[model samples]
Target: MVKRFGRTSFTLSIAFAAVLSAAGAAVALPQLSNGWPYAPTPQHTDRTYTLAAVGDIACEPDTTENAGNPAQLKCGSASLGGMPAEFATARQADAMHPDLVALLGDEQYEVGKLNDFEQSFEQAWGGLKMMERPSPGNHEYYAYTKHGDNEAAQNGAGYFGYFNGHDQNGTPYPQGQAGNDTSDEQGWYSYDIGNWHVISLNAECRSAAFGNDCSTTGNGVLARETQWLAQDLHADHAACTVAYWHQPTFSATTSTADAPDPAAPGAGSPEGTAAQAWWKLLYNAHASLVLNGHEHVYARFRPMDPNGHFDPKNGIPQITVGTGGEDLDTVATSGGSYTNPNLVTAQDQAFGVMNLQLKPNGYTWDYRPVQAGPGFGSTALSYHDSGSGTCRG
Candidate 1:
C-alpha cells in the first residue's frame, strides 16, 4: 500500500530537559512478511518514468576514527571517505524523482556496520522519502569472513539492525525481528520495477558456496543465482533484467589489481572472479544491464561477453559508477582480461555517476560528475557513450 509519513522540516535543537527526556526513544520500522527486505509497491506514475542505480559508495565519516582494522578493508569502513558528501550526491538523485533507486552494492564500506550506516542514512541519502532496494557487497560479509563470527551468520544481523533502527517511523521492514542465519542470504534478493526485472547477487562468491564445497552450492556462477536468472528471464522475455553488485567482474582500475581468487580464498586472480559466472548467466539470457563499483571511478562499456569479447548477439552492458564522491582511483593500462577494446567510455581519474535512459531500444548512458555542482565553478554538457546493440526508448 502507498503511504506517507511526516518529519521535522527544521533541524531542532534539544533543550537541556529534552536531553534527559529522550530515554525511551523508539521507532517503528517496516514489517516485512517474512521479515526480509521490501519496497512500497510500485505506484503507477504515468508511463514516463526515471530510475537511478549506484553503489560501492563505501561512505564513511570524514575522520578515520570509526574505521575498522585495516585488515578488513575488503569489508571494513573507509573512514577516509566522507558520508555527508555522498549524501548530498544522493540528494541530487532524489531531485530527479527516480521511479526506483536501485542501490548497486557496497552501500557502506569496511565492515558494513550499523554505526556507519546510521551516519550515512541520517546525513546523506535521507532526502529520498521512499524505500530503497539494496544489494549486498563483500563488505557486508566482513565480520563473518574476517573472524568467522556468528553475529553476521544470520544475513548480516548488524547491517539489518542498522537499517531497521535508522528508519524514522515504523518503516515496516524489520518489524522488530532480527535475522539469525547468514545462510538465510536475504541480501541476494530480487524485485520488479516498471518494465524491468532486477536482481542483486552477492559478488564475493566464485560459485557461491552454500557451505564448504561448490558441488552442492550456487553462489557465484553456481546454480543458485544461475537458476534464479533462468526462471526470472524465462518468466518475462520483454522485461529487461538489470543486475548489480559490490565489485565489477571487470574493472580496469589500479586498485583492483589484486582481484580475489575464485578457486581459493586469497588465491584467485582478479582475471575471472564472479564476472565469469555473471557473464555466463546474464549474457546468455541477454540481461539489459549490469552495475558495479569498488573501482572508485565511473565507466560504461559496450555490450560484451564474459571474456571481455564484444558480442552484440547477446551481451550485458555494464556501468561502473563507483564514483559517488569516495576517493578516486587511477585508470590502469594493463592489457588482456583487464583491458577490453570495446570500452565505450572510461575516465578513471574522475568522480561521477552514470545515468541510463531505459527506453524501448538499446539504452544510452550519460555520465555526470557529482562535482558539477557548486565547486565545479560553472560546468555544463554531460558526457555520453552509445553502446552496441539497440538500446533506445
Candidate 2:
C-alpha cells in the first residue's frame, strides 16, 4: 500500500436491514464502467466482496421546509462545498460494485430536510440508494429542537419518513432501499453479507434526547435501540460483525461537530459515553469493528477494548469516516479537542471512500482519496491508508 504524509495543512472539503431481518435478497445497483472525475479502477478480488462506507454527505441551499418555514442554515455553496466529493465517491463506489454501502450518518446537510435529500443527495447518490444501509445523524434530529431549524421534525420525521418508504412530502420511498420495512422509523437494523453481521445503529441519542445510557434496562429511546442491538447480537452468530452509527465513542479531534450548543458551558465535552455503553456490549460480544461519523474528518483507531485501551488481539477497531462529503476538521495534536491519545491514522484533507473487502475469515480496508484536482484544491489527495485484519467477532 502507498502512504502519503507530511502535508498536514489543507483546506477542509470533502442502509440497512429490516428489524431482525435475514438477508436472502439481492439489490441490483446501476452499472457504470467509468464516470467519476477521478475514478479509481477497483482491484478485482474473486469471492472477496467490498462494503463501501462514508458519511456526512449532501448539501442543499434551499431553506424552506415542508411547513413553508425557514430552516436552520449552514455554510454551504449551491454545490454544498462537498457535492463534488460526494459524487466522486459515489461514482467510485458504483464502479467498484460494493455489495453494500454503509452510510455512517448525516446523508443530508443542514437539518436533513426531506426535500434536500431529493434535490441534492438523491440526485447524486440515487444510483446507490437501494444498496445504502444508513444510520441517522444529528441533522436528522435537529428539527426536533431549535438547533436544527426550529421547524418541527416530529423526532426525525423527515428522516424516518424518507427511509421508511416515503418522503416527508409523502412520496414513496425508493424501491429496494436499505432498512427493514418495520423498523425504518428507528433507523436501526441488522443483516448479513457473506457471513459478516452488519448492524446499523442510531447513535444520535443526545440529539434525540434518548438517554445518557445505552442499556436495555434504561427507560429511553436509546435504551430501546440498545436493547434491540443486544438482541440482534445474541440472535446472530456471524464470525465477523460490524456496527456503525453517528457520533463516535472515541474521537481523535478536539472539536465537537455534533454539539447541541458549542457556546454552552461544558458543551464541548468529550461526548461519547452513550456510544461507550454500546461499545461495552460490543466488546463483551467480541465485535470486530465499529464505524462512525459526525467528526467531519477521517480517523482510525487501533483495536480498542471497552475501556478505550488498545487490544489488537481482542478489541474492536473504531473508524471515524466523517469525510464523505463535508468540510473537514483537523486532528488533535494536543488536548484542546477530545483527544483519544491513540489514533493509528487520520487525515483532514481530501474527500474519499473506505472500501472494506470482506472475506470469509478476515477483511481488508483501503481509504482511497480522490485524485488531485481543483475539487480537492490542494487538500492532499495523495493521502491513502490501508490494512488487513482477521475477524475477531
TM-score of each: 0.68, 0.75
Error of 1 at 255 (Å): 8.9
lDDT of 1 by residue, 1-393 (tens): 121222111111111111100112222222112233333354332243355666666454433544343432322234233554476467656665565566665677555666666666445665452545566555655444443323233234445565444355423243221211234334455554545555666554432323322221223223343344344444444446677776776655533335432112111323235346555666666688888776666767667776666767676677777766555565555543434445556664434555555544345555666553222332422444443334211
After superposition on all CA atoms, what RMSD does each candidate show versus the true structure? 12.7, 11.1
Sliding window of 10 residues with minimal summed lDDT for model 1: 7-16
Q: After aligning candidate 2 to the native by TM-score, how far in Å is the CA of 55 from where it should be?
A: 0.5
lDDT of each: 0.49, 0.63
Any runs in candidate 1 off by more than 4 Å, and if so which? 1-46, 62-81, 143-155, 164-182, 206-223, 254-272, 334-338, 360-362, 372-393
Highest TM-score scorer: 2
Number of backbone collisions per candidate, in order? 34, 11
Model 2 TM-score is: 0.75
What is candidate 2's lDDT per residue for 1-393, written digit by digit as tens? 111111111111111132221122222222211101121223222256678899887765454443343332332443234567678777877776777788988888667766677777776777777567778787776553343345544345556556555755574442223342222225566656665777787766554445433443434656556655655665567777888988887766654454432222122433365666678778877888899888878898888876677786888888889877756666766444434555778887666778998887789999977633224466587788999888776
Error of 1 at 357 (Å): 2.7
For candidate 2, the per-residue lDDT at 142 reads 56
